[model samples]
Target chain A: MVTSRDIAQRAGVSQATVSRVLQGNSRVAPDTRERVLAAMRATDYRPHAAARAMKTRRSQTIGVVIADITNPFYPELLEAVSHALDQSGQRMILWNSAGPGEYSALQAIREGSVDGLLFTTVTEGAAPLTEALVHEEPVVLLHRGLEEAQCDQVVSDNVAGGSIVADYLVRAGHEHIGYLQGPELPSTAVHRERGFRRRLHQLGMDLRPELVGRAGFQHDTARTLIRSMLHEPVPPTAVFCANDLAAFGAIDGARSLGVHVPEDLWVVGYDDIAMAAWDSFNLTSVRQPIADLAHTAVQLLLERITDPDLPVRHELFTNSLTVRGSTAHTPLDPPAEQRDSHADD
Target chain B: MVTSRDIAQRAGVSQATVSRVLQGNSRVAPDTRERVLAAMRATDYRPHAAARAMKTRRSQTIGVVIADITNPFYPELLEAVSHALDQSGQRMILWNSAGPGEYSALQAIREGSVDGLLFTTVTEGAAPLTEALVHEEPVVLLHRGLEEAQCDQVVSDNVAGGSIVADYLVRAGHEHIGYLQGPELPSTAVHRERGFRRRLHQLGMDLRPELVGRAGFQHDTARTLIRSMLHEPVPPTAVFCANDLAAFGAIDGARSLGVHVPEDLWVVGYDDIAMAAWDSFNLTSVRQPIADLAHTAVQLLLERITDPDLPVRHELFTNSLTVRGSTAHTPLDPPAEQRDSHADD
Candidate 1:
């Protein structure tokens, strides 16, 4: 058990200074704080957070609310958030919001079990977010943001990502394109669709109302949705899915109908997860710096926790296109000859 | 806003009885406790865990330590544990051990931040486990177990699972087989290998030393390991990987060298993760009842925390095989004719 006195000695500082650092006091010099943190790391110091909580009235824990854990994207985001929180010397309490109605994080924060809350997934106008803000709790939103919330948020430029996919497909002469729309409540899905639709209109390739299909997080749901959309009279030559999982489902659904990817159709996904690079999927996707987003969210939340007076901040990261085998080739012209083969469907 | 009085009125019990239930008092009658709990759930009661901690010296929180979150298996396990804890009216603090040297959970438990610790992954003779036991902190091991620990453990029978795989391969007329071994520390890996080797010896088809290769959780690591093993003059016709991820890697590695799965080579994995059922992989794997294992582990830990005098227990689950497309067919004889093309390696 390393003590504050030992940390002070190692960093050439007084025990009082070490205590101040632990309290997240801004009065401490930056260099001195860094040295103290380094010493603590080197000594494997384990601060008694419970004792400190009693004195500071802060639990030194942050509650992270995730809607789903089985989704590969959430796990990746959680890893990043966990590392970031670990660096801030704060513990993370994971709350799975089993449904949109779950408000476990808000209750946990109100009870002082956690000092702040980080919502990686939340719907627009969520009751818990409104209640948390009314109570003046430290809150930060990541991955998803609300349209009319006065809160700190760290997210990617989802609209621009969707627009990029639209432009890529249109430039490849894909006039008949389809979109997979996710649940309507989340700002991420809404903004993404907004951008995609607006861009396709600008490109003189307005998306057909019948081509837009609804999809959930489940692969089977996406498969059924896409299969029904493709069974229409004039099917899409390319499909832009809301996320990587949706894209995988779309590709498999098309293949089940004997449509060859990149030859008969092209598929694009969002959120370039690790599976996107697997030879099995080889999916083209929009890459958001999830780690950077998570780290920034943690930083903003900690700052708000340390000083409640700080103005709300919205940090947006840029998204880029990651091309892969899914959309490796964009034919110059509509293959009338290829279309003849699937005319029956 | 829901209080003990409201709960008492709803359950038709005295407020004192409701308080006893909130305090986890063992003297409360089982029927009374169930009714009080039902009323609490109906009212969406949020107990002040921090305040309760001050009065009862119990945080109503459990610290769960997972070595890696990116592994799909952990997320599934975590979902089950979270549901179980929610039912027990407890919160969960997740600690990503990040590496073997991490001991954050032990420190958190010692400081009364969490009532007990649940280790989903831990090495044999880990220092933190030993110290936690020495300090008498309630602990339970899940997914992985220590050889010489006096702690409650809930795990699937990996030994039997390994033997089943061995028996399957040998019965399929595979004399030359390879094994992809995971990290040497965890009992899940050690015991799995023990059962596999012993069963192979019993069947008179011992695993060759050259065919056994070391791999890690990373897909690329497993790919490189299996590729090198298959590059030998007398490569194996069947390979059993440590986990599903490794099996995917092995299949891809063999395919990269012009060998076909279930034709010239067969691959098997453990854990039977959801990905195993994906069309791209469709891998055969040993299925462990992960949800049951997680729920049982939580129940055991809560019992131990409520009554520290409870004797330690080990709960072992049975494993079954999930046959998929990866092993759809087995030739009547050795695949010598199919192996001729790859013999130059």
Candidate 2:
């Protein structure tokens, strides 16, 4: 069988360069790419990458499992990952794990169709994750992570992000504040909430249980939860959401009840997604370096794929707060009429 | 070699049921699923689906190529496609063709990694697409079509959608109108612009060259273009954007220039993305039934994959106009103050 080595020798190029030319990758210089193609044609060397995979057990493909594709955050992360993989001459196959697609991605790994798996969102102790780990397939976690799993992980400082929001809200003179919690499955939610509660406690403040609402990382759920919270006898003057999507929901829900944001109820969110900058939302959020996180995670996965025995690496990226119109105004007490009307409800 | 057929015979089930169980598909009944698994265990059958594919040449994977994954419209469309593929127990491998990912997807097809290809966006008569067709591959085009291609296609009524927007604007008493056009490569842009121009002509109106701006379905590009258009000697009272993303940019741009929508100008968008309903935007847009379109497109691709000789199918879905705050107010003449300000420029 003719191999890339033979083509490389014929074209006077390295084996890696030959592989890049085979991928139709643009990184190859024009003259070198022509030489490789001419060599392949002259030798009648058929390009059957799948057939080669059976011999070498490498498919040059990676499987990416995302929580929800429609979520703006995932797409931004996915785009970054896609570009990084393209630079390395690898293909990406996606699975929307929010549905039944997770198992399919696992099956792809078992069938030797992908070199490794990169999970952007995964539940701790998921069966599929455990199965992949037991088999020693290359795995890397990004953004949302599992603490118990022994794999390469890339995460932003969620705890610090949460603490910063709490400090900002308190210093802005929000005497009464609410919290919108994300689902408890992922570490992101757990750490963010932990830091927020811890910081509030240190400051001699209490987050009354009645003022806290729990929801998945979704807009509609947060909206509904905030609406009910606003009806409490002593409603909160501010609300901090676990993520940007929930913050949008909270703002919309508050608007539906005729409550003005920042003036009546300040809102802050995490993950500075692009929509946060839109004139509609202008949401104050904690910004994670998504492009940096994505690129580093892919690099880690590739490193593990090449050397499975290397030491496990956990990368923690720092976070910053982006203050926008949502939390730009100083806190104001709820109007007497609004507070009295809530008592009627 | 222990085949699923052998397990089916022992379990008193059909071969299809065994295949479903092996795939971990949820469509099988609980009792039937248990019996199938037991039979496989009793026979000591190891699941090597890749080995089976080597024989049957069927991987049960589909390649999905999308243009610009960050665009809200693509994700909405992708979620629908992911759900449809999940139901059929087929894996979806995604490629963002906005970069160099398209060639990677074609390579997958060449290596028999995917059973067929589904294109959500493509330029007319592209080289890679032509290569796929030449190889007798099962290919389907969704939302974009090529007149010279012989593959199955699924698209919405872009021409009618454009006409509807033109009629709505004309009826709103707007004398001067503008158009924010999409890229010239895709059929969606061409047909939409053609329909809008034709309708305007029938209504005894003309779309002057100075009143039109072309961009590649992006927010920032449209924003820059609209800022310049607003400086024209006779600016438009209403602007019809090719897609919702452009409308957002147009609205943001006009606001930056102190031009209030509907009072000084009206903005309309297409694709009715989820963001369109946000209170910040509340943009009037043309709504295409994305779920229906995605499901039908997948069905066509699967049918072609199954038979390879089925008659070519082209499905066209209809679109509707969603009126919202962006165009809700009465069209006022470009205020005298605004016109005077532009003249000073």
Candidate 3:
């Protein structure tokens, strides 16, 4: 039941100034805007988003298109995005793409449905969808980016993450290594593959074409692929999976083949999901700034919403290596370091 | 560009009938409504929710407030809810409560935001939230229900789920058992604990005070609590964790104390999250019909939204035991049988 006048009184600002801030006017001073935001937070004043949207022609809702909600990675990303959006008085309308073909993103982003769009599922062939989406609303690419789209983008440094894994695995003395990847469509997978190969090439090594397999972003598919690869006479002594889920599958496939992780075979994964540190998997993986990536995406989207004339911006977040039992020579990741990387961690 | 006319033609109905169905008018016949829904899905007809809300004062956006989206259980629940809502031509605005005290649900449910709410994180003593939410909106409790709130609710049979675990462990011949529970606020914990203790009493056994611990629904907290329990002079031969994350923690705690899962100590968890079937954890868990629960909750909410005068209803879904490697005797779960439990599983 709190009102803007009450917040204005508490923040020592005029009611008109508070209204201006609520409307996302660019003329307000930074300090004044900060005070108004602080007062709103202190008083728990929700400014009737739908009412405001009706008046301003903005819905105060962000359309979030996720490839799969059940994937642990997307959930983690969403947790951060939700927290950030809540602070700014924006609501998130979530759309799970279900699978590649199960959803129509173009139809979903109809006019006035949301203030903007944050997409986490921009795979390779998604250019047409993004192309159509850009003409309709302000769109921000999150986690996944499209080369063909000229929109604001925030993503993890997949290439660097891949390189970190390659560096760690090579340092651990693994020569015969394999690379397991997700679908070729996802830029995340492509960039990760690029980084891993780029680093291996720098280290005077290469993953032969026959040693790479694609799992189509499925855990079971990854397991089947790894099982076949491990059954060969000249199998890989180490493997680097595009993501942690694939890495878990590789471990299971290795176990079924009577090979122990970090002993007879070493495995590395990307995206370092929460399960990586569990006593069960103890997967060695690359840690992306999930919270930062989400926060930056939301922040950039808001800026674009506030000022449509702003030039398109792309932000890339760095990633670090989290070493665990999955690798032969990597030490166990301590809890304190993980906590230090992200505030939400 | 799929339109009401397209859906109407596909359903063999007039455009007026399709419009009536989209508006959620109670005059539409059930079979006609179903046909309209099917046609809409087939043709990928996505109604502009905001534009519709402006015209009809009924937003097709359901506000979903969850406790912690990072928890695999919640993400799984959200996946089901999103899928069901999509089929019904509605959108989901996700609000991750983050944790206790970080959000106020009643405040978040402003009048103009969403037509209904689907709450997945209702703990005991949340009377104030539901009390305010019910008067302002058509709210349906999903996964968690409040005893004090007169709202439509769909939840798992936690009492029966707890009883199933007791029955299975007793049949497996484990006498010394411990129970690891989530926070006291959640009704699920209370109901689960009640059923577990009741079954133990029926078997002429009881859990001592020292054998019970609360994890506050956190993985690390569970690990610490289980570690202390395991270090006792005489530890339990089996432990029943309220959820899979806690069960994973129990396994880790036991391993730290030189005890092995399914050999020296047995662990059973609830919710049967996707991780339970992984080659790593393979936790034996009670599987709730998550998809059915979500679908039913949305259907109930829609019914209530169409006719707010209807009597409030409650649905309790039965959960089945999914046997996997975490137990001492149960074999690994096969994927085909995994889908046989639920119709849409």
Candidate 4:
């Protein structure tokens, strides 16, 4: 283990000069920087991370708290974030919050292990943890938003996404459509519900309470809920799912019941995950600008990490509707129209 | 900040006793342990992670190096590993190895910030950084096996899985079959190829060079390669993919070319990922005992962490075939007979 002193001695420079060159300080001459780097390579000098952290008071690390990586959507977002962070030579320490509670998340926040935090909580109310993180370091919320907390957030326009689905459904001549909502507390779920309901009212269509199903953002729960929805005295002709996972469940449920998608019923999902494009699902979904959201969140967090006094920023990217085979048929189609007209409101 | 001294004073115990109780040494009396815990809670005393590391010579943290989380297989493995590590009161520090080179991963290992390393490398070659980890700390290789390195490894039997698929294909009376292979260098890929070839030879069949397509472990690349295979002068009646993602690409490729799955051609994939059961793919794949692999890796790593003198271990788990609609056809079908007659070796 060669030290800075050893490198300095070998390069015929002072230890301070070696440190400056290693840190890429502007004060160091280009020739000196090259010499120091060459000496470091030759000697295999590895800086002690703990010592560096003590000296600079910076770990050059950020914490990413994701609810679940099993969900394809979060991984895509993580990939983008990791790529952006790597560019700045900053490392991301990932923590999975998929367990029973937020205890681990809070533990990570209070330890002062990271310079900043990027949290994607499963629920909308994480005020205590949010406050704790804010007190210790700059916090940026991604995907899941907290309504009561005033924090920097980067999320897709879920409300507009829901409304866009409604618009597409209505244009396809579906008047009585059901909504499969995610967990009640997640802000994205609530906003999407609001948008769906508002658009339904605007279209002069009544939303039937029986037509709605709420799942805790899980595939099995969504499947059970959707299965029951189909068995109702009169099922809605089209169903709008809260997320891609739930949408997949609904599709599976329909298949189990021998219901032909887009023929007997139309299914639409949000968050056009990579699987949505597979030949199996071909799911019609609202594509969240995930890459844009990742870029915005990273940029915002970087700004805050550099200068914590920067005003809190909220970036809401627009969503787009990707039409696929699942929602291909219009309600005007004879059999589908008949099913739509006889549907209970 | 309240320290152990405060807790000792409040609990009427010595500082050593308080430290012992906090460390869960199990030698302390229950009453004294409870008193110390209550006093510490009352005083809001939180242990400093850095100080603890200095005393214990352990960070109580493990580094997990994953190539990509967006890949479904990696997340499943990560979740299991995280859960197992959490039960032992250890934290996992994630390092994404999706960068250009192994520099970042090597930096993490050389720094000694973590107690051990769990790596999931994409490339088959033994990286210099991996060798360094083996020499420096307790290293566990997950999924991807290294041929050169002698270290603890936990992997599903890819060779057995490949053989299972070959057996199924032969049982179904498919004489002409295509094999979609991943990159050549990876151990898993090599093992799968060996198993598939051996099983085919045992069944009195020889692998046709033209029927084998090579693609990196990526869906898009597999899609292109599989498309070309489907357009061959005389396409095989059944195709065995390297993994679920590639199987999905093959399914999509077949659909794009108006080839009906299980009707015109059969498709079987390895690694029965979550998406395999989705309404779209419904792919017949070999189920990798993920939870077992995860638990085994964690247990092996912990043993090494506890005592570095432990010998390196390699655990192999058996894989089961999951039959799905993708390859539901039987040999008695007329299409199978036609395919057998058209086979050109």
TM-score of each: 0.90, 0.85, 0.87, 0.83
lDDT of 1 by residue, A201-280 (tens): 89888889888888765566777877887888888888999888888888778866778786777889899999888766
TM-score of the second chain, each candidate in turn, equals 0.88, 0.85, 0.84, 0.82
For residues B205-311, could you state the per-residue lDDT of candidate 1 as single tens digits?
A: 88899999877655767788778987888888889998888888887787667777777788999999887887667788999998899889888887788778988
Question: Which TM-score value belongs to model 1?
Answer: 0.90
For residues A1-345, what per-residue lDDT tens digits would candidate 4 score against the true structure?
788889999999999787655433344677887888889889888777768767655566777888878978778888888887765556777788643324555565456457677777646455545555557467788887766666688988888888887777876667567888888778888988889889878988768998888975677777788888888888767899999898888888888788888777788988898888876678989888887787778767766765677776787788888888888643233355543554423
Please give the lDDT score for candidate 3: 0.77
With a 3 Å backbone cut-off (N, CA, C), the pairs that clash in candidate 4 are A280-B280
Candidate 2 chain B minimal-lDDT segment of 10 residues: B329-338
The structural similarity of chain B in model 2 to the true chain B, as TM-score, is 0.85
The backbone clash count of each candidate, in order, is: 0, 0, 1, 1
Provide the global lDDT of candidate 4 against the true structure: 0.76
lDDT score of residue B326 within candidate 1: 79
Lowest summed-lDDT stretch of 10 residues in model 4 chain B? B330-339
Question: Where does the lowest 10-residue lDDT sum fall in candidate 1 chain B?
Answer: B336-345
Stretches of candidate 2 off by over 4 Å are A1-3, A6-47, A230-235, A329-345, B1-3, B6-47, B229-235, B257-259, B262-264, B329-345
- DockQ each: 0.59, 0.51, 0.52, 0.51
Question: In candidate 1, how many Å is residue B161 off?
Answer: 0.3
Q: Using alpha carbons, what is the TM-score of model 4?
A: 0.83
In Å, residue B3's CA in model 1 sits off its true spot by 7.2
lDDT at B243, model 2: 95
What does candidate 3's lDDT look like per residue over B1-345, in tens digits? 987778888999998788778865556889999999999888888776656666667766677888887888998888898888877767677777733322444444555556777878877657545465546467788888777677888998999888888887766666678889888878787888888889988887688777789976677777888888877777777889988889888877776677788777789998898878877667899998999999899888888877788888989889988887888555332234322322121
